[model samples]
Target: MILCCGEALVDMIPVDLPAGGKAYAPHAGGAVFNTAIALGRLGVETGMVSGVSTDTFGRMLASQLEENGVSTAYLARSGRLTTLALVHIENGGATYSFYDENSAGRSLTFADMPALGDEVSALYFGGISLVAEPAADAYASLLAKERANRVVMIDPNIRPGFISAEHTYRDRLDRMIGQSDIIKVSDEDLDWLIEGEETIEIKAAAMRGRGPAIVVVTKGAEGATAFFGDASVGVAAPVTHVVDTVGAGDTFNAGFLAGLNDKGCLSKDALGSVSDDVIHHALSLGATVAAVTVSRAGANPPWASEINR
Candidate 1:
């Protein structure tokens, strides 16, 4: 089983105002949660570990997870209010304004961590969970403890607005990047984090030096590039009329993880030598899953049958 650890929150998306009043629609989101569901839907044995409120929204999120075949046994319920992200769409693309500080999901700590055994083959974590306090420390500790146990994949999924530039997050992020066996980043994230970095190879080389055995940088619409030690490969993203890119990248991680696990390349050393054919196959699966996600609204993805895998 692949374990995804992080936030599970509600994304309230804006809709056109009616009579000078704005309206919003609630959707289940949070990068880790979305990836967990997409992985489960792809027939990957997956589970989620995080905090959720006992409130209505939390119940709905849990239901959504179970419905999609993701186990929520490790989900902790609290009386605190569920975290919310206000999603704004412009020109057919989406951006999010978070409301997670001190929210229920942010309250998760090391005490709440579940015992991960040999049943778990890989561990996935990222997003704002790496920025906050006791939770952040706890997650970092968990990653450190598991570094020698399984395939560790990290996707920063950075949102500048949600993080404090003065809080030493960069140092922490750099350390986490080193601890990760696989690291995925977006073009925007790279620009924000790397500063004026041009070539994917340059960025990947810099990131690989930090620790990740394999580094993947995604270019929305254009495609993605991958790096493993001295080797590199680039694959063009599949074309599709994107509906909303909410869970596209998260599902891309899920698909790539699933494909790697299926191909028995979950180890850092194994991924470091992945062939171009394997890389493209993995990217195709990732893009396919993400394509299905973008075709629909929210973080929902295609079921296993739809892909006929």
Candidate 2:
């Protein structure tokens, strides 16, 4: 089973009513939450680990997970309010304004993280949870503690607005990156992390030096490239209708991991010997699923039955 550790919160997406101005619609979202949902819908045995609130929005979040076949077993409850992201979309590109201070997911501490059972073979972490205080440190601690024998994947899913203390967050994130076996980053994220005149390949290689065996870099609407040692594989994005790209990257993460898991390349040792052919297959699967996700509104990922690939 894969355990996704990070934020689970509400996304207030705008909906235009026929009668008047736009109103916000609550959607169960958060980078890790979306990936967990995508994995579950793809028929992967997955569970979410986060500090969920008992409030109405929080209950909605949990219910959505169960509805999508994602396990809520690892969630810890609190009386705190749930976090909310007010989304703004311009020509299908999305940005967020978060309201998360003192919220359940944001206030989580190390003590709130659940003990991992042997059933969990892989762990995934990223997003605002990695930028938010206390929770960031807690998740970094979990990564440091339990990554010994398990395959670990991380995507920073950087949102600059969520960051408070840059140095502290970078230190914690660097630690997690070092412990992770697989690292995924958007082209924008890569540019931000490693600013230079060097080629993208060079920067991605730099990320590999930080410790991950495989580095995946995504360029929205263009394609994605995966660097394994000195070899690299690229996959083109499937053409699809435009919709908000809310959970596209998160879903891609799930699809890629699911493909790796299916091929028995989900172990830290297996990754060392995994072939480029296997990585190509995984990248195609990821692109296929992400295409489906971006074709729809919000963070909804297609079920395995819906996929023809």
Candidate 3:
């Protein structure tokens, strides 16, 4: 089982009403939550670990996870309001206006953690949950506790607005990234992490030096590359019709992990010595899965039956 640790919230997407005005439609979202949903849909045994509300949106999130075959037994329930992101779409890209003050997902603490079973083989971490308050620290602590024998993956999925302080957030992020066995970062995040690394290879190596066994860099339309030691493998993005680019990264993360899982590469020992062929396959799988999401309106990932995985 793979345990995804982060925020679970509702995304309020703008939509046209038949009556002539536009309104917001609630959808289950949040980077880590989306990854968990996609993994479950991809036929991976997965579970979500986070703080969620008992509110309408929270209930919806829980239902979506279960419906997608993601376990919600690790959820920390509260009476607090749910975090909401008002999505603004323009030219097929999406932006968010968050309403997370004092929300359930942002209020998680170390005490809320659940005991992990030996069935768990790997763990994934990322998203706004890493920028949110006490929850960020809580998630970090959980990672430190369970990363000893488990393979760990992380995608910063950085949202600049959520970061309250640059230095502190970077420090926290670096700590987590250094502990991760594999990490996927957007080109934008790469630039932000290292200002002097002229080439992607240099930046990837710099990140790999920080501790991760494998470092993957994703360029929006260009593609993604994975670096390990002195070797690197890459794949191009699949051509697909335009739709709102909401959950592309999350879906890609799930697909990549799923591909690795299929190859029995979810163990720390396997990842430490992963081959180029394995990396290439995982990258291709991720891009293909993300292509399916790009063809849809929301952050909807494809099921295993759809891809015949």
The 10 consecutive residues of candidate 3 with the worst lDDT sum are: 160-169
Q: What lDDT score is found at residue 99 in candidate 1?
A: 84
Candidate 1 error regions (>4 Å): 17-21, 165-167
Measured against the true structure, the TM-scores of the candidates, in listed sequence, are 0.94, 0.98, 0.98
- The TM-score, computed over Cα atoms with residue i paired to residue i, of candidate 3 is 0.98
Which residue runs of candidate 3 sit more than 4 Å off their true CA positions? none
Give the distance in Å from residue 110's predicted Cα in candidate 1 to where it truly belongs: 1.1
Task: Tell me how far candidate 1 lies from the true structure as C-alpha RMSD in angstroms.
Answer: 1.7
Candidate 3 per-residue lDDT, tens place, 106-184, comes to 9999999899999899999999999967999998999999989899999989888878887878999999998899999
Clashes of 1: 0
The residue-by-residue lDDT of candidate 1 on 147-232, one tens digit each, is 88788999989988777753578877787788888899998887777877477678778878888888888998888888885777
lDDT of 2: 0.92
In model 3, residue pairs whose N, Cα or C atoms come closer than 3 Å (at least 3 residues apart or on different chains), thus clashing, are none
Q: Model 1 residue 220 lDDT?
A: 87
